[model samples]
Target: MSWRRALKDTARSGIAVEKKRLEPLIAVRGAAGLAIVIALSLWLFGPAAAASSAFGAFQAAIATFQRSWRPRPELAIASGTSLAVSTFLGYLTISKEPLFLALLVVWTFAAGMSWAAGPTIGLIASSNVAIMLVTVTLPTSVAQAAGHAAMMIVGGLVQAALIVLFPVRRWGAHRDALADALAAEADYARRLRHDPVASFDPQPLMEARNAAAVTPRQARRRPAELHGARGIAERIRPVLASLADPAMGVPAEGPARDRVRELLASAAALLDAAAHAIRHGEPVKVPPAALATFRTPDTGSILAGAPYRAMTRLNTLLQDVVETAGGAPQDGAPSGARGTARSAETDDRSTSGRAPTHPGARGTARPAPTTRSRPTFLALIPKALKAMRSELRRGSPVTRHATRVSAVAATGYILGTWLPLGHGYWAPLTSVMVMRPDFSQTYSRAVARLAGTVIGVAVATGAVQAASPGTLLSGALAVASAALMYLLMRTGQFATQACIAAYVVFLLGMGGEEWTQTVPERVLLTLMGGFLAMLAYAVYPAWETPRLRTRLADWLAAQGTYAAAVFGSYADPSASNAPDVRQALLTARTARAAWHAAVARATAEPVRHRGLSRTAADDAEDALAQLGRVAMLLEAHLPERGATPVPPAARFADALRESTHQGAKAIRERRVPTWDAVREALDAWETENPENADKVVRNTATLVLDTLTELSEALDTAVPPMTLDGTAPEKPDGPRNPKDSATR
Candidate 1:
């Protein structure tokens, strides 16, 4: 079969295999969801009935909300409102005024429902106050009020857990898609560097140059324009000269040409994949075979070569162009304008019978070019306005998620209020704020809540014991609570502040009870509430482990492809292209991000994903960092107009690419390459190119093969083999950093 046909068939087969592998994971997730529902139902009716019922109801509400809401301003308001209403209901139950309590309950419930349906914090707060007034009239004892509060706490906890376990699918999906795009981009960059001639048609280069020349001055101000300009210049440099003359048909004469071409193609494909992933939100797949094709050469000799020196000169030229344009006078300037005036005089003299000024004429008085001014605040206003207008015109996906989160919070609030789950009424309120799918935020909130509860309980116990229950004492406590709440709120630690404030209110509302006698009970109740909140936060967990792992794999794959392209480009220097350079940079950036995230997540949840936990994430991060440095070198050496003293970055890129591919291949095949053999190949290449003077262009096929193979092998060994069900093994017990394990 033709190589092209074989390649196409392999790609198709690989995709199919990957899809099949993923099916079981989807099934496992579904089953987990069902199991949670059943467990929660059973817990609600089991021996710890009071706590269970309240917690269960809250959990159910949160679950429903997660299924519906998208995080946004509207949802934030809705969730806040739901919390206020629940707080009011707890107050009503404690007061024991049946008629007033019933009315307030109805009001709070209705308000919560309304807020959930359409988010508004003001409405929710107003409803909460109305319920609180009714609570003041109830004839209940302090003990009874505390019991109801306990139930509320339990309910909120359950809800929080469920939300954690089952995160919204859309967010995860989008993240995965972004990873795919990055991988494809890296591949593209590598290919272009390896085989510039075949990878980029001359027409596009010409068109790009024309566009650059004709681009509106204002358009150049865009950030992307700068990147595009640089990329185009680098990619087309080699081809530019050839296109001008057409006599530079320097074909590869050896076996290396075919290999080089293949490497270039692979790099291009990877970059294309990355672009697709970023644009469309797809998954990234790195092929194992690509890694087995190349070997890296030593870069020291290449760096000392004449071609490398020439490339450096080109970079200086490009810089000069930028400076020249920046220094130029604006169009339509007055004849006497500072910089232009001198140029105008020169032109006038040249047009007349006088001697024209030499291009290098200096020491003569010439008007300094008008300095480009920095943008002012007023100048930025139009851009800001444009952005705002764009946002207003476009629909946002986040809004939907926000709404769902609010609805869940509201549901939890109402259920906790109505169920009367003993002295932990505030637990549901805690859950509303703490139960986020993003584990990082949730964990932070939970810790804050626990700390605040401890402090609040201590204060309440001391104050209650010291003061006799009466109007004056209660009023004083209330004032103190409000003051503390206000102060803490400014710190932006909402959950902690709320917990402290609530405790003060609980103490004041106890109606003259002796604090010394009730200290133990109060502490226990507070602890219970905190415990419930934590549980709810963890129950419905969305495992970040798989996502992190997958991202690492994709990044490694991209690096391998990039390396191969770099090698090929060095072997035959005429193949540089703009798209390839851009892809390399983009892929490197993505890989860096992925590595960081994985490391963080693993540290946060070390015990959950087998022994591969945070350590594995760290290792991957180190590897990516090394790869990133190499990519930067490749970027630096890309051909550009008028460049001289080019760095040996292209040769380095080629060698690195080969090494990486071989490492990856070894990992995938479960056969480690002899370190000496790999080293020897690299040494030989480096020796031949010491100053890498050849100027012969490398292509994709030659660069990628060995590096890809090595990379595949390394990654396979580092990460566990995909199970039949396509899931990693459960994490083993070990000391782990909570921060690293948590995912946001």
Candidate 2:
């Protein structure tokens, strides 16, 4: 985590190109929108107006490319409206430097704080601030500024209209997200056949859940196949794990193990077929081999008890998947109508009780009909305000980022104006474009921005010199550059920035700037702006390394609650506990995702990993993963509602919850958790009705205790007393070097 190593990694990441499939059709649509705006403006208002209008179209096109579940036209319209408002307000203050600078600070700060909502919102908001800096200077009078602002709105409307008319792969992102989740489960099932204890990443499932959240209007128009399948896919993961796990009593090497392998392989095939169908809108094709494996009976077989029950549930869920994937009827109802009901029944059966003695029996508690709803666009205004208010605290990263960006923007503008640069706004524009909330992004973007600007400016300059293109040709070239930008949008920052630079160059040429004057000034101002951004981050940084322990503690606490909820559901198989269990699982997944992201960001920071070393962190994460897996196995074999309730499980659940809450507090204070309460509860249970409890519950309790022990031992390595500066205190033996065992 030294500065030199961090710099090397960030630089490499800055230039790395992602191998994403290019959506040429979508690119063509966006370019056509831009072309329409430019051609109309050139015919009516000339090149100056065309140049100003292109910003709206170009920005709206970029907004469509963001990873969001919202409608694409909505995104374009929102981006255009916001950019237009900023430009008009910016024009009002352009006559007074102090007022304009004050407005710049407020706008940029608001843009930075928008990260609290999500990256998509933050990036679009930031682009508005940057574009505002340039667009405000395009008009010379109040009347002219009003015209420019009106044209900006027109540009956005045109882009939105084009998207509505010629849609490319509508809801394509949602399909891919849901399909990826199922595909991930399919991959996990295959891996478990060989390595029973293999860990599965929950990121895909999390993304699928996000994609599934829909507005009421969207729900009415959604594809039939996209509904309810994700919930089934979630249930399949644990069943696959439990059946293959040797701890669940499947013999390591026997006919039973062989049969389990066949079931897993068959499940994988079915899932793959379902994924392909959903992703590409093709018909689901069931493989003959998979159908045969599912039909294999457990009669006269070595697999019995827990394994037998898991086999039954797996077959039932896969049937649901097949039925749902093919848009077929389930129990004489259309898949769309019965999808939620079947998924709810499926989850209730999995967690509420054991599989029915026969397929005809149902769980005691039935889930009410439900619909997924998300905040409407209007509702988001208050939600965004609340998020911004929460981020106003001193410790919030968003607040720090806002302050940093505001200061850098004002400084860049003042320096630009004082240094006699013809276009002073380009300096602040570059800074706003490159600065981010984290150290790695801020530095990497600075590098990428400078490099891209140099290449883009040079290439455009050479072209202009060779072609000596007039205003009309310049407008065409700008549109072409925009098309290229859209094509390379997802590739990497370096390539996107290069295209943006070229687009800006030709765009300005339409406004009658000579290539000789514009190109050199842009390159020099961009370099200066990038340098200021990098320096500002180094002076006032929000390093993720210091927050690694906090993130880890949060994950530990969430995992404990999830395990408790699973046990509670078994102790009392009420419909209420079912939702609690589902909610706990979701909370744990979110925490785990946050922890992983923190670790990834911290790896490129120059600070020491505050409390946890690299090896200790890995060990701790593994132990937590095992804890979740054990809970999942127990969940797969929950008892029937009328069956005997394990009363002792209720007490153990409370004990686990309290113990982990305390343990998390200890973690934040840089101490190893003793887990005394959990150990005592286990001992009391073992001493009191050890023989009366279900064998599966007893065995799973022991496994949970073992994982907790592993966790405590792993954290012991990170318990060394440390100074405020993230370095270990001197001991009798020696002082620990931060570089030797870094947290990342």
Q: Which candidate is the best by TM-score?
A: 2
Over 4 Å off, model 1: 1-425, 438-444, 460-499, 502-530, 533-539, 557-588, 606-618, 642-710, 716-744
**Residue-by-residue lDDT tens digits, candidate 1, 1-744:** 233443344233322211111222322332333234324433443212222222223222322332122222222233323443454455555444455445444543333333322232323333233223323323244444444344434444433444455444423332333233334334433554444332222222222222222123324342221122222233323322221111122234333334334444443443343334333434333333332222223222322342323223322222222222232332322222232222322221111011113323321323332222223324533654454344332122122223333443444445445644533334434444443334444455545555555566666656655664454445345434533443333243433345354434443343443444334443444344445544443454444554555556556656655554544444444443333544554464556555555556444442355424455445545555445333334433443322333244444555555555554444334333223333344446556556745333322222233333333334445555543455664544642222224332
Q: List where candidate 2 sits over 4 angstroms from the true fold.
A: 298-300, 327-341, 344-365, 721-744
Please give, for residues 1-744, the per-residue lDDT of candidate 2 as tens digits: 898998888888787778889999999999999999989888888888889889998999999999999888888988988899999999999899999999999999999999998898999999999999988988888888888888888888888999999989888998999899989999999999999888999899889888888888888898877876877788788888899999988988989999989889999998999999999988788887886786765522768888887887777777777777774443422223343335442342234233343334433234543456678877887998899999999889999999999999999999999987688888899999999999999888888898889999989998998999999899889989999989988999999999999999999999898888778889999998999888888999988888888998999999999899888866775335665777788888899999999988888899887678888899999999999999888877766555577777888899999888888887887866766677677777778785845667877887888788788778878768544455765554432222223334
lDDT values for all models: 0.38, 0.83
RMSD of each: 22.1, 4.6
- 10 residues in a row with least lDDT, candidate 2: 734-743
- What lDDT score is found at residue 292 in candidate 1? 28
